[model samples]
Target: MTDERSSTSPDEQRSDPHDSSDGETADADATSDENDVNENDADGNDNADEFTIADFHDASQQEGRPVLTAAAVSRALELSHEEANERLEALADRGALERLAVSTDPVVWYPTELEDLTDRERVVVFPKQREIVVDRPDQFTRAQLSQFAHLADANGEQGYRYVVRPADIWGTPHDSFEDLARTMRQALGQRSDALEEWVHSQWDRAHQFRLTTHEEGYTVLEAQSPEIMGNVARQKLDEEHVHAPISETEDWVREGSEAAIKRILYEAGYPVQDHRELESGEELPIELEVRLRDYQQTWVDRFAEAGEGVFVGPPGSGKTVAAMGAMAHVDGETLVLVPSRDLAQQWADAILEYTSLEAHQIGQYHGGRKEVRPVTIATYQIAGMDRHRSLFDDREWGLVIFDECQHVPSDVYRRSTHLQSKHRLGLSASPIREDDRQTEIFTLVGPPIGTDWEALFEAGFVAEPELEIRYVPWGDDEQANAYGSADGREKYRIAAENRGKIDEVRYLLSAHPDAKAIVFVDYLDQGRELSEALEVPFLSGETPHHERRRLLEEFRRNERDLLLISRVGDEGIDLPTADLAIVASGLGGSRRQGTQRAGRTMRPAGGALVYVLATRGTREEDFARKQLQHLGRKGMTIREQAVERGED
Candidate 1:
């Protein structure tokens, strides 16, 4: 009978989509006449001649057999195999029939009564009240499938019948179910109606809404209901009504509200999924070399316990090393954000030197190269750039370390907080901002987790700092008059640029001829003047990034004893080798800036010295005192030293 037809004939044989029960092929042809007689008798009419695909489906269901091969139906109906095959395929396309794979080359058609098909005949099953069944459950390992079944059984009683919470799944002591059901669904190659219902339920109850960024660099909330929209707009000010310029259906959040929206969602017990693809980072290749100091260890413990917060420590107190230790403890994909390219390089070097990460694993995402790896070191400027924003948009960082976190309150840099991270650590010598935006830091990064500098100095983790306030007389009479007359910004600049401060710089350099020192000035001109007069390298904002790196390397290598720096040196730049720091000028009355400069020389050495060259009996003295307040609170004594050049 098989050889009576051509090989290309539809009934001649092909692989069945449904795995046929054993010996069903021989029975299929034998039952053809019986099926036709039964169908005619059941209908009580002569409609066997006009039977359609729908009629075939109804007959199969009524006969309690949901699956059929095209050849069986063709023989039963006395029609050509080609016509029957085409009709069956059309029914399958219309959802009245389902096609299942039986072998590599053949498929069989089934009526959509999935539940009626026995375990032997069906490959997959979605039971309404019973556990899911799969005939070929070989997609996952037996152990994996067993674990999934266990979780399903446990959580099924907890009202999460179809959906699995990641935390609940991962929190249990089991092998990693990294992608949860998403992975399982992909492997199964089928979707359950129950799973779709669960997804819809989750979406309806989700407290966290996505603040997605459009191509124009704007962000908007994907609000589903009026209540959610109202909740989002509750804190918006009167002038900031929700706008929907993109579409009438969707409401747009104001620019820079992304962080606020995230905070809101987090507080409401809804963790927003940023829909970013995260790289599964590899394990560390090497172990750490230096053991953290006792205080540093305590701070790390606290940071790990809190999961997110700012770590405030004195300069030269090993904040960078502590941060690296935290990363090693977490041992995940880390993104370290810095204010400058120099600091980014410094972080990269620290990661390589201290952690198990190799040179290839550490990528610098700044001016020259933007390669992202297991450990990415990026600058705030680069992170805030619109073109570079995509690098952070869809990526998930396991640990995010913000060096000099005080800079994050600014509008340009605050956008860096939008990058999703599991754990956040903010490292800063002083998190105080001039604009009273320290609250914003607390909001973005958690509250300040601080270690006392006095305790660190007592423990010998950091050098004891000796503060010397040197009185330099104002040499420029015209500038002196301008300093007295000018208000606000001009007055501060005039006082900071006093030419007599250069004499103090010369004296400090002369005093510390062999010691490695950093001369910090507020203005670029002051730094240049001192650098040339003292015959040393000058680093400022205008200095090329490569040259700055070279100069820093030279200082580190002890090829240069004295180097001049500007405002750029106030933050996370590590100059551990420098034993002396001469503050030539500074921003008027910034305690944070002063503490950071003093910290520049506080690395554990024999001792550290900081000389504040200020014009006595002017606004400079008050500003200088304000800067000293940070150290004063730490119990470091400041001594007044009058610079009497000829007398000395």
Candidate 2:
């Protein structure tokens, strides 16, 4: 029977090969014949030959052992005996299976279940240690181990021993101890102690706290470790009696509190990192067109030292020039935020004349143009718009100069300050606001850094002014009735728009024919009527922006000695040549407006004159007194002069 079986047809030999003794070969052939008979009986198909790894896995699981034999797989999958044996060997090399007992006639294979691997089996076969166990063997891949082996061999390093815990080795979690050991061994192959140094560096980074600037003008404190956040919050409560809610990821604070918070964190011994850094600006020329005055130089030096603050100096005391000097000192990408388009243009002109920036480098961001450049001069109105606000989302300004920053108390105007900058400078003649929101400026920018006006005047940096109050009687009884009956805004309008002030404006212009004068009024209609009656150029909110610029230029060139300007000209418009001013109307009890109107003629051209016109024996008298009181606080004396009906 053995000789006949060995000499069996080539087809039978190919189906099930036996290379052992006659009795063993007969047993194998009997088993193969039994498997064929069982398969044919179960499915009645003799030609089916297909198998997969999943079939072997299922068979091992059902048998309650990690072991699966070739004959069992062949019967379960209906594949040829040779095909089953080839597939089993392939799976064992892939780490999915292991050769359990090779001494047996038919080698017994065991499937390697990463999730269920024993401690002994989880140990890597490296020569460094007898026992290096992996906690989770399921998280590692075979490719990772292979790469590690290749990298270690390339570096000519061997016998790596891992002393760190598995959790610490990976810095997070890993499934396979062998794979993790391989990766660490590979990383350390470059140099000795490299893996230990890397783990320590990761721990330090994960524990550190950092501050990042958000688009909404707030700073976010990022803490990756929950334990660190809890520690910080507990310490804050103990020291300051404040309960700060701890977030696993981050906390938020106002931008204004960034300095204070950083200081607190440092004092508490917390490792704090400031993620905000000053961006390197484009290089500008060091030379300046205009030399800084003594006081201006002092102001610039102080501003550079402080980095950010409100600079308070009277008009014509070189506040704008001092700001220009500060910009030159910093020599970075600058953004000048002004309250009006006229001031925006003036800033643009000042930048071009004083600094190395060219016309192309200086862009105007307003209604007409939204060009962006290294230096941007924008009005608050344009910067407050939703579309324009988005333009600054990613911009990092090196310096931000807020010209006439008193306007920042308004909700819409305050939006312009949402931009992030390394340095900030607020320039204002009178930092006070009518709404008593000066504290907002201190919080958003910084506290006031003042320059003495009286000192400047004594030093000849500012021109002394001759202040006068001219009282004009009402035109008729009908005007008196309207002023008496109106309330709220109407009463102020009626009082300010008294028709008799028109004659007073005309007289001031004729009296100062050779002296360049600016006629300032509170109401647009009053300014228009006076401009038409006196036949002079008028500038108001309704005036086209380009035309307004042309008119101011014409006035500067001596073509028009007298120009009629409304309250829009009260702040930030530089009329240095104007030696005389006629204030016919004003917002009631606005100290800022009164001071700005007086400052229009404060240029250093020998001396200047300011004539304030008020309606006699009415509420205008009281409001005028208030304006004069504000000017008096600034060290100006006013002489009252009564106008007869035909004084003009």
Candidate 3:
């Protein structure tokens, strides 16, 4: 029901079409105004369009109830008679507010007509909740008050109620004044204390809320509900585009969306307790006959003492071997978590070689393969599939080892609250990066098992390689054109695979003629281009998995001195025999990939050389700098020998 024009005042009448003195003009103008209003109404506009007292009243009680009088509602809201009363009736008719006749002469209105009037509202406030009230006594911080107000504002139907009777608040603790303070805060905003004091002093109202001090002189206030204290939550999906499993309940705010709330909860602080409670003296079978290196033993000892932590070891550093050895010495079933199916298969084979451990019992779960037994190697993707439940909730994994510890800090892995293995270990080579969130690896897995990359590399346990970073000039305008797009990957490929890099690769090969080498590229076209230019066999995702393996084997056996591989060679599989790595193209600006690629040539077969070809004066050089920053190199060292003059 829209507002009627019958009660227009003299001021409002001037604007109304019917108020004109010319009788013919009044009817014509009225018809035109009505048509415009009808068109606006058909478009379902309310906020932009003007409303009348009748419209306000009708809007207030569309379901067949008397709407709150505009004059009374306006006075109550303390707005001008016209401004307040004008929209009040229509808002009420639209079910935005409820008309409650508190008195025959003085009517009242309430927002939202919720059933449970005594319900409490929850808000996820930030910074620490404990600190919000710990020291403050005479006053509550603005943040605290605002949080309370946001919660309480929902108590009224439309927004916040200006006045909530004292008797209406229920379930508040005796002598607790936080709820009253919160309510007063909502009504007063920043002027809550004044109103609160006024109410208590003049009206002789009891201060229902109180604060108590602890032995430490910390003021601890009882939990108080928000001003509105209404348990209504927005029906929306989470910020990450993932829907909550329990769609009905409002307890858990969409995960990352409620960071402030989580912070408050964290500030509340949980008691620290050791997650590991290993049973004593009942050790299980130890089958593997493994000779642990001093560094490997040190990693195990640190892991046992640290409770949970990560082990940093480059490729061929025996990270997996050390982890397996540690598992063999410990009792109970071990859970090995790998990144992909290829790694899982590699781990399964490696573990079998170390121990007469039943190969059948060593289960692998990833891709289409499924096996569950005493020992299982599951991929992170499958483990993090169910966000609500833990990955190992149904069963217990005594020792959980994440092969790629860097992945453990990812948001997807963090959501796996069910990965409750207290005795856990993470193995990775390049842990430090630009995205230091990977530092959460400490929180998720444990402290560092290896001190630093250099420590492990120097101790002869991990690989050590001499790095050679070269600038690859672009071929034609192709490289320059690719950099214009937002695709960072293409930018990297363009710079890395520039024709100038082909000459450098040849130079590095000529420089170390006898050393077996593998050229790493990010794109298949780059690899193909390099393969044709250098007359070498190249490997990519398009290459059959078996054929790629065979090609790598041939190169390792000296049948081929050079093998060109795309990013597929960044992880998994092994190249123990390759003594030199030529990084033609790489994942731009990714420090992890840089370290892992460098580690490819760092295997214990004596020290090797690593050459990284980066395009100069482009984003590729910037990415190279970021990758090498953590490598402990303070300055850029390069030998720029242009193979072609003005040709590229």
Candidate 4:
């Protein structure tokens, strides 16, 4: 099993009378942290005559606590409680460490010293590991990091961890290495030689190959050096994919093998830059009905500059509107691909509502409808069909949009990318998968082109949802025994379907009776049980499309404040604005699923809340934390609470 634990930040922990309030304090009174708490301390304590900032950092990370109370500091530093507080307060007085006082403990302390870090005090760079730890980074720093680094996790407080992956280096939206390097310096406030060298090498690797159109109107793949063109491209591809070598550094790519070539080279770690002079199709003028947000305009401008990109933002961050802005910029025939018919219809209505496109100008192609117009919305399944593919393949689409584009790597959705659209655009809040195929999403669609979620949240452009994981005790011994006797996924299933969650769900609904809420479940039986208990409608895949639409419409119109939905509500269903989201189960799903469920409530003006119900001390607890870690990484505070066997 994956080790992605649902571990919370130290301060978010609930005080338990049985456990030490300050982490092992009961056993650590006489024990020296030099040997017990920290591994790096053995070498460091002897090297320094006095305690250094690195010691504090090491102690905090080793103890898995961001903010420590006086007892922890006293134990780790081997000082008296009063002395530790005096020293910590002295540092705090000098603006080295910051402290927050809570009712449950003496003032908790931040390890870093702000006075020494300058304006970049919040950013900590570990060049050797290619990891960045930022503490309470500002919008500017977060924005700079988004340009070249991937947010790996957040401590659900002030701390964020970012990792610079190969895909991030390959898909950096900068025009040149100098610009990217400059951005790194700006974000970090200092140049890191090791990190910069690695980044430059990866940046250089991305430019080693380029795809350009020949004067004869066919595609040619060129390499930076003849050795790469032969040793890499030619060595990997056969005659079926590449026709012949145009030269030592160039290859004549066979027809209908462009996507294959791109995918192949991408897998080989050299992202081919597309510079081909492709078609713009027939001009179809369009205008946006609403004014674009500053960030949305930036997304459009970046796409227009890059010619292809995926809009990666939180759900309510207006990606659809930004896409319409892109359509207005492209001003040509567009093909929008969706995961479901409901999304197709939502896209049509959104296009009409947010843009100047008339009803006749837009059409939908799916199982129920087959209409093609300047702006055609089609399901990915229908477009991937052999018989129906021709309609899309024959069209000279100027722009192709993949909504919910996380499915692009799947076998069915992968085929839809075969359509020869000049400008490929993809839209997804989480462009991630449970498997390793996530990189192909970038290769096939485009590099991610959107601001950081925290930036949007900070600017009040999108409401940052408050996420909480509530651990409920089993309702009875029978269920607990069933969970204990079960094995593997069966155990997870038992925990997920715990009868206690039903009570928790009812409690949450009663607490927020006026708030529009969605209760999500994985299994039909669990959903039915919750539906019956709460007297709410259960909307699952088994529900007819028309009925589903009507229920969603009623929810959107504020006629219904509650609905129990299955996995079908996870994505692509245009779920209406909700102030509350409760995951009754399904924590075993992908991290993206948690984000999508929470995103249903992330509107601009309202206070968004998400509660995940995990059976206490069961496997569901870990799954709950791991799945929602994505949201935490995006700068949302996640709190945890343990419940009694009975209702409060």
Question: What TM-score would every model get versus the actual structure?
Answer: 0.57, 0.58, 0.54, 0.81
RMSD for each model, in Å, please?
Answer: 28.8, 37.2, 27.4, 12.1
Which candidate number maximizes lDDT? Answer: 4
Please give the RMSD of candidate 3 to the true structure.
27.4
The sequence of per-residue lDDT tens digits that candidate 2 reaches over residues 1-648 is 001111211101112122223654465456445545544553565543333344565555445556667877766667678988888887777777767666665577765763442321122333232122222222122112322222111100122222343223222223344344435443222112444354445435424676666676556777767777677744562323222444675676654455445445544544344455444355544345666654466568766765666777777666776777777877777788887767778778866766666888888888777878778888888778887765455455678888889887688887766543367788888877878777567446644565445444544556657888888988767888998888887877887889888877777776766677788887888877887898887788788878988898887666777788887787646654467888888837588888888877664444578888888877777788876675554446567888898856
Candidate achieving the largest TM-score = 4
lDDT of 1 by residue, 1-648 (tens): 011111111111122222333444345344444445554564686543444444564445444466777766776666588877887887777776788778743777776756543322222324344244333232122222332332132111121122244222321222233333433443233335574354334434442354455656555555555665455544432225345534432456665454575555544534333322222244544456666655566678866665666777777666777787678777777788988777878777766666666888888898878889878888889888899876675556678888889988899988888643357789887777878777567557655666545445654556667888887777668878878889987777778888888777776677766667888888887787777787777888788877887888887666666778888777646554467788888847588888878877665444568899878677788788776765665546677776654432
Q: Which digits, one per residue and each the tens of the lDDT, describe model 4 over residues 368-443?
A: 9999998999998888888996667667888999999999989988987765338889999888799968888877
Clashing pairs in 2: 136-175, 137-175, 139-175
Each prediction's whole-model lDDT (CA): 0.62, 0.62, 0.53, 0.80
lDDT of 3: 0.53
Give, for candidate 4, the lowest lDDT window spanning 10 residues.
Answer: 1-10
Please give the lDDT score at residue 536 for candidate 2.
80
lDDT of 4: 0.80
